[model samples]
Target chain A: MPTHRRIDVSKVGDVTVVTFLDKKILDETGIQELGAELFSLVEQDNRRSLLLDFADVDFLSSAALGKLITLDRKVKSAQGRLKMCNIKPEILEVFQITKLNKVFDIRAGEAEAIAAF
Target chain B: MTDHISAAGWQRTFELKSDRGASRAVMDVLLEQLGAHDWEPSDIFAIHLAAEEALVNAIIHGNKLDSTKKVHVDCRVSRDHVRIEITDEGQGFDPASVPDCTLEERLEAPSGRGVMLMRSFMTRIAYNAKGNSVVLEKSRAAAAG
Candidate 1:
């Protein structure tokens, strides 16, 4: 298994549950590392179902959003699934503001997100 | 480099490098001052988001991370509102020509949403004719809570 610094990886049944280690995902270097770790799950690990739990994330910038968009594309190209949950209300407003709420599968909780996968 | 405090509010000016780390440090100070002034959490979040977008745009897109270029920031926080102006030393682009990121076909594109988010969160956002300078203002009452 490759070492990861920006995310915590676990297995819930067949689904891969990834959690962010940073509360604020605004720094460029951090976002780049995060994007690499997320892309690796699909590109190297061949994880078919991925669930991103944002329970620890308090903030994110447009650059972070760009990473998620790229990750979503990578998963789709790999014929995999991606879902996100536990986004705080403030961050959810960001998704709604950018209309990204329509682009990804968002759920209310981890259980709900996992079940959907 | 200039910081002024009065009975009403505080103001500070900074000349930052065209680097993310440099900009992040400045943002931390701004957020700290906002908290000290007892700004509402939601309002702080909005200000932080807008400021982050604008700074990143100036540092990355405007200045292109040129080591020689500097990004100037002027911030004022009053009881009722906060205003920030960021100017970069680069050839500016037309803000009016920025495509709408919320459009149906453009929804999946990741790069263009920064400008839109700034406009949505700030009470008012204006860019200089040169396009390298931008002012972001948010009034407490107008903040989307």
Candidate 2:
């Protein structure tokens, strides 16, 4: 079974907001569990819109980034939109350097992200 | 040949097993200390991200997560720079051979992004001739003076 222990998934209107419960998401096991939860949302629940709230996350490894990229693709293929907000400036640099900033819909906070959807 | 150096303001080296989880744990503690020292937010990000990528590559790609293998790291944080060296105990691959992930065709590819991230964030990145060792260096934030 997929465990959502490291994350809090809630709904804000029609959008699904996932807030990371941990300070850092770097371990393989944590990434695997998170991946399972996210994929289940897309494949089974068919949740279309996603807002990843990173207010609590301090760091993310490349493996974690890979998982996010994979999840983004899955959401897109399902004709759903995925976005993230409240990313720490340091962690946000990763997305900018990788040019994923151009690929993902990024906003300043939950209110703005939800409004965009 | 120097296992210890006082030239840099801060220096530490760890001989780590090829367990990704343990390696990250060690890095976490070191990063916390660096943060406490008031390393610039940008410099901290670059160093931490580059170190994580390099360490992961050494443990997973190089050592294949083999518990028998080991990874070595040397970290030096001076007033104006953060330098890290990572070495693994496996056959190496050519760094030049990695594809350009920025290309439209390769953006979605799962692999090869780590090398790209390291190069993007670090000011200087180089691999030893054997390709088993990598060095990442980033200039620290300018002094507030």
Candidate 3:
């Protein structure tokens, strides 16, 4: 499994919580690293449910959005699900504007996300 | 369709290779410039995402990730708005032909979502006649009271 630098992976009662450490997701290297690590966690770590905590993330580029959409598809194919929480208002607006809000299950916070899973 | 440098403002031009790696460095400098102007966090997020999408399109779609091709980024920041022009050295396409990613039928498709996001976040988005260059604009402040 690849080591992720931009995202911190942890466990919350059998639910995998990945927190973004960077405020911006514009870096190509960071985006690739996050994508690779999350895929590995879902496929190899036997983690079926993921809660992506975006507390530290303030900005999300389209490239990063594309990666998330792809990751969501992969997790679903594996009979797992992906949920996002703690998304900043500005960042959430991006999802809303793109109507990606309908694609992923988004919760308000860690507690809500954990409860959902 | 919009002029990038019509007034006195912070303007910079970066000549970068088509490699996607160059976008990070470019975005860093551009973000720093916006920060220096004390742009609000919400406006900063919108400008950053719009700029990132344009740069990625220039490198990947316009230049086809051909390292030999060069991407030109011209940026201008003012009190009221931010304008970024990304031009690539490759054959252009028709911006009108991009599919609407918001529709349910194409929601899962990845290629056209970037264009849609760019259009959504930016106050105004325009492509040059050749479509190889895109101009993205974001308003930093609400319309004059």
- Give a tens-digit lDDT track for model 1, residues A3-113: 999999999999999999999999999999999999999998999899999999999999999999999999998889999999999999999999899999999999999
Off by over 4 Å in 3: B1-7, B141-145
- Candidate 3's displacement at residue A51, Å, is 0.9
| Pairs in steric clash, model 2 | none
Between candidates 1 and 2, name the one with more favorable TM-score. 1
Q: How would you order the candidates by lDDT, starting with the best?
A: 1, 2, 3
lDDT score, candidate 3: 0.82
Candidate 2 local lDDT, B1-145, one digit each (tens): 2334465667778888888575765576667756855777766766777788888889989999999998998887766777889999999989999987767787776557788888878888999999999998877543222
Which is the better candidate, 1 or 2, if ranked by DockQ? Answer: 1
Poorest lDDT segment (10 consecutive residues) of candidate 2 chain A = A1-10
> What range of 10 consecutive residues in model 1 chain B has the weakest lDDT sum?
B136-145
Instruction: Please report, as a residue range, the 10-residue window in candidate 3 chain B with the lowest summed lDDT.
Output: B1-10
**lDDT tens string, model 2, A1-117?**
345787788998999999998788878788888888888889988899999999999988778887888999999999999999999998888887777787788999999999999
Q: Best by DockQ, which number?
A: 1
- For every model shown, what is its TM-score relative to the native structure? 0.98, 0.90, 0.89
All candidates in order of TM-score, best leading? 1, 2, 3
Number of the candidate with higher lDDT, 1 or 2: 1
DockQ measured for candidate 3:
0.66
Off by over 4 Å in 2: A1-3, B1-7, B36-38, B141-145
Rank by DockQ, highest first.
Answer: 1, 3, 2
